[model samples]
Target: MGALGKENKDLTGVAIGISVLINVIGTFFFPRLLMVSGKEYGPAIIYGDYKNIWVYILSPILGAVSARILYKFLEVTKPAKPEPWHCNICNHNHLPFF
Candidate 1:
Protein backbone atom coordinates (compact mmCIF):
# COMPACT_ATOMS: atom_id res chain seq x y z
CA MET A 1 0.00 0.00 0.00
CA GLY A 2 2.91 2.35 0.67
CA ALA A 3 5.08 2.13 -2.46
CA LEU A 4 3.27 -0.18 -4.86
CA GLY A 5 5.62 -3.17 -4.85
CA LYS A 6 5.46 -3.96 -8.61
CA GLU A 7 3.05 -3.01 -11.38
CA ASN A 8 2.56 -4.59 -14.81
CA LYS A 9 3.89 -2.78 -17.88
CA ASP A 10 0.48 -2.55 -19.48
CA LEU A 11 -0.90 -0.92 -16.37
CA THR A 12 1.96 1.57 -16.33
CA GLY A 13 1.40 2.38 -19.99
CA VAL A 14 -2.26 2.96 -19.38
CA ALA A 15 -1.44 5.37 -16.57
CA ILE A 16 0.99 7.30 -18.74
CA GLY A 17 -1.48 7.44 -21.59
CA ILE A 18 -4.18 8.71 -19.28
CA SER A 19 -1.86 11.35 -17.92
CA VAL A 20 -0.97 12.53 -21.43
CA LEU A 21 -4.59 12.59 -22.45
CA ILE A 22 -5.54 14.68 -19.43
CA ASN A 23 -2.68 17.12 -20.02
CA VAL A 24 -3.51 17.45 -23.70
CA ILE A 25 -7.16 18.10 -22.93
CA GLY A 26 -6.17 20.64 -20.34
CA THR A 27 -3.95 22.39 -22.91
CA PHE A 28 -6.90 22.75 -25.27
CA PHE A 29 -9.26 24.02 -22.57
CA PHE A 30 -7.05 25.89 -20.07
CA PRO A 31 -5.33 29.27 -20.55
CA ARG A 32 -1.91 27.80 -21.45
CA LEU A 33 -1.76 29.60 -24.79
CA LEU A 34 -2.20 33.00 -23.14
CA MET A 35 1.12 32.53 -21.30
CA VAL A 36 3.02 31.66 -24.50
CA SER A 37 5.70 34.31 -25.08
CA GLY A 38 7.78 32.66 -27.85
CA LYS A 39 9.17 29.28 -28.99
CA GLU A 40 7.36 25.93 -28.82
CA TYR A 41 4.91 24.63 -26.23
CA GLY A 42 7.54 23.14 -23.90
CA PRO A 43 9.73 26.26 -23.80
CA ALA A 44 6.72 28.54 -23.48
CA ILE A 45 5.56 26.63 -20.41
CA ILE A 46 8.88 27.13 -18.62
CA TYR A 47 9.23 30.78 -19.79
CA GLY A 48 5.90 32.29 -18.79
CA ASP A 49 4.98 33.40 -15.30
CA TYR A 50 1.34 33.05 -14.28
CA LYS A 51 -0.10 33.49 -10.83
CA ASN A 52 -2.42 30.51 -11.24
CA ILE A 53 0.05 28.24 -13.13
CA TRP A 54 -2.62 25.77 -14.19
CA VAL A 55 -0.67 23.44 -16.50
CA TYR A 56 2.48 23.13 -14.41
CA ILE A 57 0.37 22.73 -11.31
CA LEU A 58 -2.26 20.38 -12.72
CA SER A 59 -0.02 17.98 -14.69
CA PRO A 60 1.35 16.48 -11.50
CA ILE A 61 -2.17 16.13 -10.16
CA LEU A 62 -3.18 14.18 -13.31
CA GLY A 63 -0.09 12.01 -13.10
CA ALA A 64 -0.77 11.29 -9.45
CA VAL A 65 -4.38 10.43 -10.18
CA SER A 66 -3.31 8.12 -13.00
CA ALA A 67 -0.78 6.46 -10.72
CA ARG A 68 -3.43 6.00 -8.06
CA ILE A 69 -5.79 4.41 -10.58
CA LEU A 70 -3.04 2.09 -11.80
CA TYR A 71 -2.25 1.12 -8.21
CA LYS A 72 -5.88 0.36 -7.48
CA PHE A 73 -6.16 -1.71 -10.64
CA LEU A 74 -3.05 -3.68 -9.68
CA GLU A 75 -4.44 -4.25 -6.22
CA VAL A 76 -7.64 -5.63 -7.71
CA THR A 77 -5.74 -8.04 -9.96
CA LYS A 78 -2.99 -8.96 -7.48
CA PRO A 79 -2.93 -12.43 -6.01
CA ALA A 80 -3.43 -13.08 -2.31
CA LYS A 81 -1.18 -15.48 -0.44
CA PRO A 82 -0.61 -16.70 3.10
CA GLU A 83 2.47 -15.74 5.03
CA PRO A 84 5.46 -18.08 4.67
CA TRP A 85 5.75 -19.07 8.31
CA HIS A 86 2.76 -20.71 9.98
CA CYS A 87 2.16 -20.62 13.73
CA ASN A 88 2.35 -24.07 15.18
CA ILE A 89 -0.02 -23.39 18.10
CA CYS A 90 -2.82 -21.45 16.44
CA ASN A 91 -2.26 -22.38 12.77
CA HIS A 92 -2.01 -18.71 11.83
CA ASN A 93 0.63 -16.79 9.99
CA HIS A 94 2.10 -13.33 10.56
CA LEU A 95 1.94 -10.91 7.63
CA PRO A 96 5.73 -10.58 7.33
CA PHE A 97 6.60 -14.05 8.61
CA PHE A 98 9.08 -14.64 5.82
Candidate 2:
Protein backbone atom coordinates (compact mmCIF):
# COMPACT_ATOMS: atom_id res chain seq x y z
CA MET A 1 0.00 0.00 0.00
CA GLY A 2 2.86 2.38 0.82
CA ALA A 3 4.53 1.54 -2.52
CA LEU A 4 1.26 2.12 -4.37
CA GLY A 5 0.84 5.47 -2.63
CA LYS A 6 4.40 6.51 -3.60
CA GLU A 7 3.78 5.51 -7.22
CA ASN A 8 0.57 7.50 -7.30
CA LYS A 9 2.36 10.55 -5.85
CA ASP A 10 5.15 10.27 -8.46
CA LEU A 11 2.60 9.99 -11.25
CA THR A 12 0.75 13.06 -9.99
CA GLY A 13 4.01 15.06 -9.78
CA VAL A 14 4.96 14.12 -13.33
CA ALA A 15 1.52 15.11 -14.61
CA ILE A 16 1.74 18.52 -12.86
CA GLY A 17 5.27 19.10 -14.21
CA ILE A 18 4.14 18.30 -17.77
CA SER A 19 1.15 20.61 -17.44
CA VAL A 20 3.32 23.51 -16.24
CA LEU A 21 5.83 22.96 -19.06
CA ILE A 22 3.08 22.96 -21.68
CA ASN A 23 1.56 26.14 -20.25
CA VAL A 24 4.97 27.89 -20.31
CA ILE A 25 5.53 26.88 -23.95
CA GLY A 26 2.06 28.04 -24.92
CA THR A 27 2.58 31.36 -23.10
CA PHE A 28 5.66 32.15 -25.22
CA PHE A 29 4.39 30.79 -28.56
CA PHE A 30 0.75 31.97 -28.63
CA PRO A 31 1.54 35.67 -28.23
CA ARG A 32 4.31 35.57 -30.87
CA LEU A 33 1.95 33.81 -33.28
CA LEU A 34 -0.66 36.50 -32.68
CA MET A 35 1.89 39.26 -33.28
CA VAL A 36 3.09 37.61 -36.50
CA SER A 37 -0.49 37.50 -37.75
CA GLY A 38 -0.60 41.37 -37.53
CA LYS A 39 -3.63 41.30 -35.28
CA GLU A 40 -3.71 44.57 -33.29
CA TYR A 41 -6.22 43.10 -30.88
CA GLY A 42 -3.76 40.48 -29.60
CA PRO A 43 -1.34 42.61 -27.56
CA ALA A 44 -4.14 44.94 -26.59
CA ILE A 45 -5.71 41.95 -24.79
CA ILE A 46 -2.94 41.48 -22.16
CA TYR A 47 -2.02 45.20 -22.06
CA GLY A 48 -5.63 46.21 -21.50
CA ASP A 49 -6.66 48.94 -23.96
CA TYR A 50 -10.11 50.43 -24.54
CA LYS A 51 -10.03 49.19 -28.15
CA ASN A 52 -10.05 45.51 -26.98
CA ILE A 53 -13.33 45.65 -25.10
CA TRP A 54 -14.96 43.11 -27.41
CA VAL A 55 -12.05 40.72 -27.06
CA TYR A 56 -12.12 40.92 -23.25
CA ILE A 57 -15.89 40.56 -23.06
CA LEU A 58 -16.34 37.80 -25.63
CA SER A 59 -13.39 35.64 -24.54
CA PRO A 60 -14.91 34.56 -21.21
CA ILE A 61 -18.38 34.14 -22.71
CA LEU A 62 -17.11 31.92 -25.52
CA GLY A 63 -14.90 29.97 -23.09
CA ALA A 64 -17.84 29.32 -20.73
CA VAL A 65 -20.13 28.22 -23.59
CA SER A 66 -17.47 25.88 -25.03
CA ALA A 67 -16.74 24.44 -21.59
CA ARG A 68 -20.42 23.80 -20.93
CA ILE A 69 -20.82 22.10 -24.34
CA LEU A 70 -17.77 19.91 -23.73
CA TYR A 71 -18.96 18.99 -20.23
CA LYS A 72 -22.40 17.98 -21.53
CA PHE A 73 -20.84 15.99 -24.39
CA LEU A 74 -18.60 14.08 -21.96
CA GLU A 75 -21.49 13.45 -19.60
CA VAL A 76 -23.60 12.03 -22.41
CA THR A 77 -20.76 9.82 -23.70
CA LYS A 78 -19.90 8.33 -20.30
CA PRO A 79 -20.86 4.71 -19.54
CA ALA A 80 -24.40 4.38 -18.19
CA LYS A 81 -23.72 1.44 -15.89
CA PRO A 82 -21.14 1.47 -13.12
CA GLU A 83 -19.40 -1.57 -11.66
CA PRO A 84 -20.86 -2.75 -8.38
CA TRP A 85 -18.82 -3.12 -5.22
CA HIS A 86 -18.27 -6.69 -3.97
CA CYS A 87 -17.89 -8.00 -0.43
CA ASN A 88 -14.69 -10.01 -0.14
CA ILE A 89 -15.83 -12.25 2.77
CA CYS A 90 -19.20 -13.37 1.26
CA ASN A 91 -18.14 -12.88 -2.38
CA HIS A 92 -21.34 -11.10 -3.20
CA ASN A 93 -22.14 -7.71 -4.75
CA HIS A 94 -23.26 -5.40 -1.92
CA LEU A 95 -22.71 -2.02 -0.32
CA PRO A 96 -20.56 -1.81 2.81
CA PHE A 97 -21.64 0.12 5.86
CA PHE A 98 -19.00 2.12 7.67
Summed backbone clashes in each candidate are 0, 0
lDDT of each: 0.60, 0.55
lDDT of 1 by residue, 24-55 (tens): 77668864533332334455468774555555
TM-score against native, each model: 0.40, 0.35
Q: Give the alpha carbon lDDT tens digit for every residue of 11-68 in model 2.
A: 5566558656765787696663331223656567668875645654575578569756
The parts of candidate 1 lying over 4 Å away from their true place are 1-7, 31-50, 54-66, 69-74, 81-98
Over the full model, what C-alpha lDDT does candidate 2 score relative to the true structure? 0.55
Q: Please list the residue runs of candidate 2 whose C-alpha ends up more than 4 Å from where it truly belongs after superposition.
A: 1-26, 32-48, 76-98
